[model samples]
Target: MTLFTDIGALVASAIGGMQADGILPGGLDLGPVTVEPPRDAGHGDMATNAAMVLAKPAGKKPRDIAEALAPRLAADPRVASAEVAGPGFINLRLETSVWQEVPRAVIAAGTGYGRSTMGGGRKVNVEYVSANPTGPLHVGHTRGAVFGDALASLLDFAGWDVTREYYINDGGAQVDVLARSVYLRYLEAHGQEVEFADGTYPGEYLIAVGEALKAEVGDAYMGKPEAEWLEAVRSFATDAMMELIREDLKLLGVRMDHFFSEKSLYGTGRIESAIDTLKSKDLIYRGTLEPPKGKTPEDWEPREQTLFRSTAHGDDVDRPIMKSDGAWTYFAPDIAYHWDKVSRGYDALIDVFGADHGGYVKRMKAAVSALSDGRVPLDIKLCQLVKLYKDGEPFKMSKRAGTFVTLRDVVDEVGPDVTRFVMLTRKNDAPLDFDFGKVLEQSKENPVFYVQYAHARVHSVLRKARDAGLDVSDTALAGADVAQLDHEAELAVAKKLAEWPRLVEIAAKGHEPHRVAFFLYDLASDFHALWNRGNDQPELRFLQEDQPATSAAKIALARAVSVVISAGLGILGVAPVEEMR
Candidate 1:
C-alpha cells in the first residue's frame, strides 16, 4: 500500500529483467536502488537512481543501463512513460489510471494506507520529556513532549514496537528542595509563617500539595523535627508534582507508557552493576580531568575522581561517574537506566532531550554503546525552544510558575489538537515561533486548520453524495469509472497521495515526525489547487450534476486526499475536523 516501494520494486523489476537478458551484467545487485520524487518535479513524477546507483558496481554505463531498462518499465501497464534523463536518471510518469485508483485505495485503507513494516517489528525505546518532577512542565517541556509523542506515533506507523517513556528525576537534590518547599507550605497550612528560601521552589502549583498534606496529616508534623518529616514530605510532594505534570501532559494529549523513577535506580545495586560492567571493559577509571578547554570554571580543581572514559566511544572527554567524596554523579543513574533499556533487548534507543541538555548527548550515547556492545544504536533528538506569541506579542509567564510559562497554560488556551499540530509544523531541532493568532487563523497560513479543512471538505462531499442516493461508500467508490480522473490537476493530487507510504518510511527512519506535517501541507496544497480549478472548469468539479458515474470517479480523488490528511493528522495526535467551526 506504500506507493513508493511498489514503484521502486517495479523499477527494480525492470532492471532485473535487463540483468536476466544480459543487457545488465548477471548477478548485478540492485539493492542500492532508489525511486523517489525528483527534487524538482519538472524532471518527472518520480526519479529513480537505479541505473546510476548500480552503474559502478555492475561496470556498465549508467545511461546505457537506463536506456536498456526504460523500455521494460514503460511496458508495465501502470507506467505511462519512463525516459532516461540527464546522466541515467530514469524519470517515470505513471499512467493516469494509476493515480485515479489511489483514492479508492485510500478509501479502502482508511488511515492505514501509509503504514509500513519497515522496522520489521523491532523494539524501539523512545525516552522523552524526562523533565525533573519538581514542578509543573513548562513551555520547553511542552515542545519536547509534543515532539516525542508524535515521533513515537510515526515510528509505530512504521512498524516499531515503540515504548514512550518518561524518566523521573525523583532521586535528585531538587526533590529534597520539593520536600523543604512543601514543608514550608505545610507550616503555612498549620497557620505558621514560613519563608521560601533562595534554593526552594516558589511556584504556586505547590499550594494544592500543601493543602493535600494538611488533609492527609493535619498538624501531625507541625512541630516535628526535620528527620521525622523530611522522608514522608518528600514522597508526598513528589507524587503531587508528578500528578500535576501528568495532568499537564494529558492536556496536550500526551501519555507515557512508562514513568521510570530515578529512585528505583538507587538502593538496587543496578548502578553498581552498570559501572562494574564498564569497569570490566576498562571504561571506568579513577583520574583527574583536565580543566575544560578555552576557559576553566571557577570551581575547577585537580582531584582524583571515578571517571568514565566516554571519549573512547566518541565523547569530547572522559566524564565523571563518581565525585571525589564517593558520591555517584548524576550521570551514574543515567548509565544504569540505559543499561536497563539494553537489557530489555531493544534494537534502538532514542532519547528526546531539551536543547539545554545538548551537553549530555555524547556521554549518554557512549554509555548505551558500551552497555549494548555497540549492538544497539542510540539517537538523541534535541528539541529547541518554542516562543509562544499572542497577537504579535510574546506571551507572558504565569505568575504561578514563577519565571516560566506552564504547559497547561498553552494547552488550555489552545485545544490539544491545535497545540500538538502547530508544535510539529517545524522541525524538532529548529526553534519554532508558535503564534496564537496565526495558528488559529482560518486561512492557509494556519496549517492545522488548512489540513483539517481539507478533511472536512471531503466529509461534506460524502454527505452530499450520500443524500443523492449514490452508493458512495468505500466499496461503491472503489468500483467507480476511475478512468474519468484524467485531468492533470486531479492526477497531481493523486501523486501526492501516493507519496504517503514513502514519507512515513523516511520520517520514521530519521525519527523526525515533522516531515509528516510538511508532507500534509504539500498534499493539502495540491488538493486545494484542484478544488480551486473546479471554479473555472466544471468538468473538473468533484460532483457531476445527476451523473453518478463521473461523480464517483472524481469524488474518489477527493476522498483519497482526505484519507491522507487524516492519516497525517492522526500521526501528529491531531483530530481531524468534520466541519470547520
Candidate 2:
C-alpha cells in the first residue's frame, strides 16, 4: 500500500495502448520514464517525465508528445486529469475514491503495508563493525554497527535473505598487543608490579580477563617466558573481549548471524588458497610496489613481494599479497575473507567500513571481482564519524584499545530504541552530530520523539474510542465505514500511507536505510498536521458524538498511521513507545 499500483499501472498501460493504436511510434521503450512527486505539491499528486525522455528518440516535440499522451492517461478511471506542465512533464491527479481507499488497504495489509518484494529473495551478505577483538567497541564502531544492523533489517523487509556478520581481527599484531596487556593485568592480579608500555592497552575492561587467567591456573605461568604465556593469553583475552562485544551488541539490539575469525583463516590456509586462485589467473606475481604517493616510510626499500594485480580489476595500483620477508600481508587475509563470502553463493555483498578505510574500497572490490569473476556485485559503504555532543558542549571519549567508550556507554546513555533511531537520522557517508539535548527533546526536530509521539497519540485516541463503546480493535477498525472517509484532509493522510510500498523498493535498491527514517518523519508530520486540523474543524476529529460510523472511519485512519509507525520503528530496531515518558 506504500504506492498506489493502479494509477502507475494504468498510466504505463496507456502508453502501451498508444503504441498499439499507432498514435505514437511502436517499438519504442517507454520504461526509462518515471512517475514521481513534483517539486511543488501544488503542481499535482504525481508527475512523469514521459514526453521529455522520448522527445529526441521519437523525433517529436516534447509538448506534442505530452499533449497526445495526456488524454489517453486521463481516460483511465483513476486519473482525474493530466496536465502538461513545464518541460512537458505530465502531471496527474487521481480521483477522490482512489486516495480515500488507501486507509482501508492499509488496515487490510496491517504491518505489511510497505513490505516489498524488490530483492526477489536473493541472498545478501552484510559485514560491519568488525572491530578488533582487542577491546570493547568504541563510538566510531557504534555508527557502523547501528547502520549495518538497520540496513540488514531494511533489506530483509524488502525481501532479501540477509546474513549479518562480524569479522574478528584476532590474527593481527593487535591481538598480540591485547595478550601482552592482559598479561600485565594478570601479574597485577597476582600482586606483582608491572609497567604498561607505550603500545600496551591500559583500561579497567581487562581486569576481568586478568582475574579469569588467575582462576584458570594459579602460579602456573607466573615466571614463564613470553612464548609460554603469549598464546594462552591471546586465546583467553580474545574470548573475553568478544564476550564484551556481544553484550554491547545486545544492549544495542544488534544480533549478528556469524562471527568470522581472522585466526581461523590464518591456520586453515585460506589465505594461501585465495592467493593460489589469484595465481591461477596470473593476478599474483612477485613484484615491488612504488612507495606510497606522498610520504615514504623510513624502512622503505625495493624488495620483491608477492603482489595481486589489483590494477587489472580496477584498483588505482597493484596490491601486495605477501611482504618482502615472504609473510602474508594484511591484505591477504582480507582477500580470503571476501573470497569466502563470494564462495557462499551470495548474489550481493555489502561491507560497511569506517570513512578512513576509503582507500581499501577499490582493492577490496577488485578482489571480490577477480574471485567471483565479476559475477557477484560488491558494494562498500563508508560511514563517516559520529561526533558526540552532551549538554550543548563537545563530548570527547577514549579511543584507545581498552579505555574507550564502549558500545555499552552509548546504549546506556540513551536506551537502545533512542540510540538506534537517532543514529540513522543522517546518511551513512555524512557526518552525524548526536546532540544529547536535541535527540530527547519533545519537538518536531527530534525525530525520535516526534515519530514515537505520533504512535503514542494513536494509542491515546484508540483508548478513548474503545471506552466510548465503539469496537476500536484492529478487526473492528478494519471493518469500519471507510467509504465515509471523503474529507480532503482525511484522504490526504491515506495518500501518504499509499507511498510506503514504493519507498521500500527505492530504499532497498539504493542500500539506504536513512530514507526510511526520513519517510517516517514526513509521515508523522502529515499525521500530526491532520490531527491539528481537527481542532478547527469538528467534523475532522477522530471522535464524533452520536456518530459511530464516522468515528470508526476516522479512527481507522488514525490507527493506520500508528500501524505504519510501528512497522517502521520495528525495522530501525526501535520499540514503538506506546506512551512517551
RMSD of 2: 2.0
- Local distance difference test values of all predictions, in order: 0.88, 0.87
Each prediction's RMSD to truth:
1.7, 2.0
Can you give the lDDT of residue 131 in candidate 2? Answer: 92
Kindly list the per-residue Cα lDDT of model 2 for residues 1-581, writing each as its tens digit: 54445566766787788778876787777777888777887888888888898888888899988998899898888789899997799999888877777777788888887888888999999999999987788888999999999999999999999999999989999999999999998999999989999699898788888989999988788999999999988999999999999988988889999999988898787888988999899899878888876756765777777789999999999988877677888999999999999989999999999999999999999999999999999999999988888867887655434556667777777778888898899999999998877877899989999899999999999889889888988788888878889887887788788888887778888999998999999999999998899899999999999999999989999999998888888888888977877
Off by over 4 Å in 1: 26-29, 296-300
Candidate maximizing lDDT: 1
Predicted structure 2, TM vs. truth: 0.96
In model 1, the number of clashes is 0
Q: Estimate, for each residue in 332-365, the C-alpha lDDT of model 1 and write its tens digit.
A: 9999999999999899999999998899999999
Q: Against the hidden true structure, what lDDT does model 2 obtain?
A: 0.87
lDDT of 2 at 328: 85
